[model samples]
Target: MNFHVTNHTLYVGKIETLGVASSSILQIGDTQCISLYSMFDTPPESVIVGPVAPLSPPEGAESAEGEDDRNGDAEPESSDV
Candidate 1:
């Protein structure tokens, strides 16, 4: 197999998010040759369908109750000069 590419130009201003999933390719420039292969076998019985639970807080993170203090909800202490 033989391949050839010439005079390729690409311009981008902004990209918010870009995701490349399994067996996916994102090419931005010219290339001489490329090859890719992927295989997937999924059984219907092995898949689970259910409501997604809320994500748990990360380790060593402050609890929701403590977040209020940091968010400046409490009134500041008045000091008399």
Candidate 2:
């Protein structure tokens, strides 16, 4: 099983249906879609049994933003100035 989130689109492969819900209780189509955040809160006991490659950020650690000045060891400004 593999799960991936790219460009705000989540892809879940190799799913197994535990049980079917009552159609009278709630309206459901042929396929069911669950939010990733909801699944993130609590995962199933024993589902998803497979190895998948780890995903990396689309952009590497190459930010154009300037570095923070406070990170340096420069001394603080004097009150005399």
Candidate 3:
């Protein structure tokens, strides 16, 4: 396999999520050679699928429900005459 790319331009503003599943390949640029091999011992029935749970926020990080409280807890500034 051979690839000749010239004057290639790629602009990305935002990427929310990118997922690469098992036995997959993600190539962005030109490559001279690529070899991939995957071996699995588990049978087809061994695979388990369940609901995807939402990840909890990190410690001290505000939760989505508490976004409105961000500016509500500021103490009032006192004026000195």
- Model 1: per-residue Cα lDDT over 1-81, one tens digit each: 887756656778876657977677777666777777787778895565778654567776664443355667765574322
**TM-score-better candidate, 1 vs 2:** 1
Higher TM-score: candidate 1 or 3? 1
CA lDDT of each candidate? 0.64, 0.47, 0.64
Error of 2 at 65 (Å): 75
Q: What lDDT tens digits, residue by residue, belong to model 2 across residues 1-81?
A: 998845555566765666644332232334356433222334594455668544344565355343345577544574332
Q: Pick the candidate with the highest TM-score.
A: 1
- Runs in model 3 lying further than 4 Å from the true structure: 1-4, 16-29, 44-81
Candidate 3: TM-score? 0.30
Candidate ordering by lDDT (highest first):
1, 3, 2
Name the TM-score of candidate 1: 0.35
**Each model's TM-score?**
0.35, 0.18, 0.30
